[model samples]
Target: MATQLPVINLMGPTASGKTALACELYARGNYELISVDSALVYQDMDIGTAKPTKEEQQLYPHHLIDIITPLEVYSAAEFVTDATALIDQIHARGKTPILVGGTMLYFKALLEGLSDHLPSADIHVRADIEQQAAEQGWESVYAELQRVDPQAAIKFKPSDKQRIIRALEVYRLTGEPITQLQAKQVKNQPYSYAFQNYALLPDRAELHARIELRLQKMWKIGFLNEVEFLMEKYDLNDNLPAARSVGYRQALDFLQKSDRSLKNKAVMEEKSLFATRQLAKRQYTWLRSLQQTHQFNVYLSIEQAQEDLRNLYG
Candidate 1:
């Protein structure tokens, strides 16, 4: 009988050492690291995103990173499809499949199986909404959305530009509220594998300090240049998901000289740091929500994770 190898998942907020732990496990053999990150999948977005170095990738082959260009949109549905096939192949080779990432939505989609009828992007409609948003502001956009999708409007804040635009796009494409279509989707499973999941969270104070430190490090490592390169290298703007990423936006702000009120670069750095911390909080909240919703096990540290591993597969 062929053994069905288990999949280990290491998940946490940014700077939570997921890559380090995944790398350590890979070094010990029996695993291939599969990325569930949306950003890492994009090419030419190396240092700013804290993507693993070439040497690190050489040490253990990574799947899914650099699979697409920034110009191309990637989705969780695609990730689930591709990663499942890779995992199956790894299992056939008598190896374990280890999925690692901080992207909670991607992880949830992979595990619980999202509705196959995911709403697709309509660029033209989204661009129109964005243009409307720019001219008339978020409230006007929300008002437009309410006319088409009162229910979706209720769930979305006026400031949620991305979702609001998407809702509008869905309306334009199908002449039906996206919420209604999503409500009717069938949940189907593609494949099944045993999951060992962990979330690494340092102490609250420690996490805050680490967030500040990492943001500063990102600035030092030419995060501004990286953003500039992305702007020059790709057809990205403030509306894209990539532009809304932590540090990138503030880097954009600083790059654009929008912080004219600030006297010095340190002030800009502090604002960026604060934004990154807020981002971390949202990430932690979302991850904790997923844990509650799915009842997936979580560990606070690698040592704790190792203990859980011993008990699970020992």
Candidate 2:
């Protein structure tokens, strides 16, 4: 019997030190970084994504960053495919793959393969759904989900527009609940490799403070200007996936306003911070769910992570 190689998953909330821990591990050699982030996939959307600096990337290369344009949609299904491939490639190169990011959907999809029976996303159908959301409201759409697929509807709030729309789309296309379809998915257990998961679970107040400081820094470093440039370059609209990302969405709302008053700017900052903290809350929920099935080397601080990984790799 041969020992299996390990594939590391470094997961945490928005402002957690997952990236820094991954980078430190990479600095020690024999590790390749693969970003699991949904937002970091977009090219030239660096500032708001908290993307690694160009110099940092040059020194410690990360795969799957800047692989798509802002206009393009990158799904979790696609992420599973890409990440699986990258895992193989990195192993072949005699390096361990470290998957790191806050995008819990991507992590979940990769951990458990998506159902093949589920229908592919229909652009026209999705457009119709979006139009419905625009004309009506997400509450109405969520109501539709509840009416059609109550089981799925219970899993998401009305504010979870993306998943709500997806469930409705799946229901409309296949006449089946997305939850039912998901139940049929084959659990992805890599026979040749083991997943060693690490979670950075900071205290809520501590995490909130980090989020506040991070967003304040983003604003200082021209995050709004970056959003402005992306909007102009891509002809972006509020409906686009990239435009709807946490900070970018709030910034878009702020910029589209006729008045760029200080009060309005303050509101934008407040909203963006709230959205980011909400994102962290959702991530914590995912982490808890993941904990139900998978074991993680949990750490509440970067020093703890460093100490653990040092022992593992040293």
Candidate 3:
């Protein structure tokens, strides 16, 4: 018998007001929030990751928020291990676990195990590949992967060197063609325990507008200063994992320029806003894919979400 209760996932594009709706639902249900976001695990990345403030979090207890250090990297595989344990612990205490966030990989990993598709990256091999990508343009490098893993290469654009390198790295590290290991899930899990999900999905224009407004808010909240502090203290240059994160990339561009000319505030605002919208587009794509298998409903109104939660709990 399955001992765990069904999880209610609240996921959508960034700046979709997931946290606010979650807070409202937490009030009506015997639930604990288990964040599935990749970025929210770190401390001091609060605003860029769209993390709930101390006051908002005080509205309800949260798990997996500050569990990772800024210097260390977290992976979807490890997140699943930790989250499964957290879910079991929460269920044992009689509170349902509400898995929330836009991280589709975390949700996929939790629902189904990591696709054995790719081999783990060997640091030395990856270092060599990164060097190769920089020295010789990514076209030559991806050409190399196209020879071995054409199927994977077909999906990645030539300019997306990061993913190209990952594919080539997998082949070099493990003699297995990385694409060969992709597996289909073996089970259609029955819902024996109570579970429900909601996503606050605004139209594309509204979502884009909200994303733009959010960037302005983050800029005002000292996002540039936070990136500067990381560069100065943590040696977090352009190549670090955290530096490659969404808003941080544009912020780094502002910090590292020689002329120091782009700090017009408006430029940073535009770049941050644009990058955030791009990130949301990718997130929306992932969430739509998951909704096919998971039974999450889209909520246009917070009132409907709250009413459903109250009825579920009572």
Which of 1 and 2 is the better model by lDDT? Answer: 2
Tens digit of per-residue lDDT, candidate 3, span 1-314: 65546777777778787777677678877889888787888877777887889987888778889886666678776887798788778878987888888887777777656764555445567678878878987778989988999888888898777678778877887765567755433333343444465776677888887788887788788887888877777777665566677888777877786445745556766777787788788877877777888777776655666676567654
| Candidate 2: clashing pairs of residues | none
TM-scores of the models, in the order given: 0.89, 0.95, 0.88
Ranking by TM-score: 2, 1, 3
Better of 1 and 2 by TM-score: 2
* lDDT accuracy of residue 36 in candidate 3: 78
The collision pairs in model 1 are none
Per-residue CA lDDT of model 2 for 4-66, tens digit only, reads: 888999999998989988998898868999999999999999989999999999987999999
lDDT for each residue of candidate 1 in 1-314, tens digit (9 for 90 to 100): 44445888778887777788778778776778898787898887776678998998999779999988766777777887898899889888888888988888788877777665556665566778888878988888899998999999999888777788878887888888889888875553545576667777766677787677777677677776787888888856766666666666666677666654546566777777787677678678878877775546666665777666655544
Task: Give model 1 RMSD, 1 decimal.
Answer: 2.7
- Candidate 3: residue pairs that collide: none
Stretches of candidate 3 off by over 4 Å are 1-4, 116-127, 184-195, 262-265, 301-314
Point out the worst 10-residue segment of candidate 3 by lDDT.
Answer: 183-192
* Candidate 3: residue 38 Cα off by (Å): 0.7
lDDT of 2: 0.89
Off by more than 4 A, model 1: 1-5, 188-190, 257-264, 310-314
